[model samples]
Target: MHDFVRTPAAVVAALVLAVAAAATPAGAAPATPRWDHFGYDAENSSFNPHETVITPATVGRLKKKWSVELRSDQSCSSYGDPIVADGRVFISDYLGISAYATGNGAKLWSHDWVGSSNSPPSMAVADGVLVAGYTDCESMSDPNSGLIGLDVRTGKELWSGATAPLIIEIVIDKGVVVTAGSDIYNDTATVAVRVSDGKEAWRKEGRRIDVTSANGTVTGRDVNGTGTVAFDVTTGATRWTVTRNLSTGTASPAGDVFYGSSGDGDDLEAVSVRDGRVLWTAPDNDGVVAVDGTRVYCSDDNGIVALDSRTGKQLWRSDLPDHGALAATVAGGVVYTAGIALDATTGRVITGTPRLSFRSIVTGGVLYDSDNGTLTAYTVNG
Candidate 1:
């Protein structure tokens, strides 16, 4: 009983387009690579596997594309590496946190805070949520620290909750936000909360547990700084614990090993994650350490050294112009440290790479460098 009417071509095309749009998933992965964590992910590997643009061949042509000024005052300085995700970049310091466009450095939205005295803020972003930590500068005697989650696209506040007295680290993984820092009583604590509702999942306190997560386990060094304990990230159940004479630094986790320094500062040791047994040790390295699939990178008083991940054999070493303590990030077959690029395999400095005052992060075909209060973006020139 339907009338036989011929539909217009334009009308038919519009109807087909609407149906296709509705079938797309709301939580699809981003089209471009993202540097979404403090060390790129919950493992704190400091290596971006998705990066493909700033390779050794193209790094020499990187030129500044845009720059933006951040809030600089007596209370705040740009604290750490810029976090990039969802087509925007986020930065946090002692004062507050802000977001900007990744392509042009345009200000998108910013949330500023007051009374953040000596405690600098920390931030982590995942699944379109940006979580930031704040301190109670008003009460220095018994200071209160907390975290706030925001909608990454619109800067909308989603949820906020209080945590330990000092939040030194924040990592988002498996839909949980894990924070590690000192508690009100000057004891180190690690707390986990759900990212969806900001509800407390579990808590571990009474030690200097510098925590990092991988798979479903959260591993951290114990109160003595020489022992490590692995816990179930969801229930805080102790999985394993081991004590050794290891140096007191944040352990960077790779697939099955935790890379750390020896107590005497003369060697780098790789400890197995399953049983906390020492795998191998490489000598003549100390300071910040980063790891990729095949090589482990470390910075010392001399310069940067690369060691085989499995056997702890030295591959190469490249000297920086001025080096004391430096941060290292690896991406696209290039090792970025102290604002310069070195070939990942050879440890040779890229000839024309610009030297930055602070450590820089490379992702999505751009180099993000922050100094004092200035944030600059560099792209490979034609």
Candidate 2:
């Protein structure tokens, strides 16, 4: 509509611009594989399907790619779980929130919440937005707690909302951000917030609240003997409620199923995500549960057991060297626990690397040992 330059120089510039645009594909600039939430996704699967490079044949040769100390002075400790997304790794610790380059562990950016309550922040990332729970340490008896959302690339604050007293865990799923915290009354509560904007969706009161989700539904167990409840992830409507003696306060979700332990802390049970119906039960289980889409892994004081996710049938059980001291992460056909990597199907220790630190996470063929602050990448050696 306006007057345009039609000279020879303008024509050459137009040709150069067109060539440059053709060189790059749409959304190709920053597209990368991301481990966006706790347990890799809303299901807390702890399983990575995109990780084809690290397999049973190659896990032994995994070498340390790089490591970054979140607390260089050892003044604070890293808490909660980290998330890998947008070509970066984000972590929240006692010191503050920080991000690193996923490939090399180079420090990208960091933010210090000056009044931190000496607790670690649990974080989740979605669509370049990082959400984390933190507490203000103005006093030991009464500290302010809240959740903050930041721009994943720049570490800029997007929005924040104050709630509860101690925000411990966070999960982002189905466009809903849920956070659990212990209120001032010593009871735990789960607060659901909309992801598009920092707004409260619903709040429920309980104790030892452990939250998990799958298929647009979220579940939690109020370890105060109130049992478990499932709710619609988007609307926060109660879908089902099951009253059982759930003392462990932990549950793992896989699709429409979840596994939990009883108040006696010995019997492990699986329940339906739809109507809270008990599907199957395995006795003498300690209820430390994790699902890898195909199998349900549970640990007790004596050992670890593998159950078929569909039928709750016992596949194999492995005795732990640490006597269940270390938690388990099931992925890539390997059950990593207590510094031992076991074949998931056979329950045989594949490698006693001893370097498999407690509370480590595997994503995109890399094992991140948060216990010692190290990141190791794996490859299949020919």
Per-residue CA lDDT of model 1 for 1-382, tens digit only, reads 0000000000112332343345445686433657777666666677766555677888898899999888766652345458888889998655677899997999898776656634545567767788777665676677767788889988888888656547766656678777777756767777778877788888877643443555556566666456667777677788887765543233344446666667676877787767778888777777445676577777767687777777978777888877732667777777777767777878777888775755677777898888877889989999
TM-score of each: 0.84, 0.81
Q: What does candidate 2's lDDT look like per residue over 104-144, in tens digits?
A: 88988987775663556656776667877666666667766
Clashes of 2: 0
- Candidate 1 similarity to native, TM-score: 0.84
Q: What lDDT does model 2 reach? A: 0.62
Clashing residue pairs in candidate 2 (N, C-alpha, C atoms within 3 angstroms): none
Q: Please list the C-alpha lDDT of all candidates, in the order they appear.
A: 0.67, 0.62
Q: For each predicted model, how many residue pairs clash, with residues at least 3 apart or on different chains?
A: 0, 0
Pairs that clash in candidate 1: none
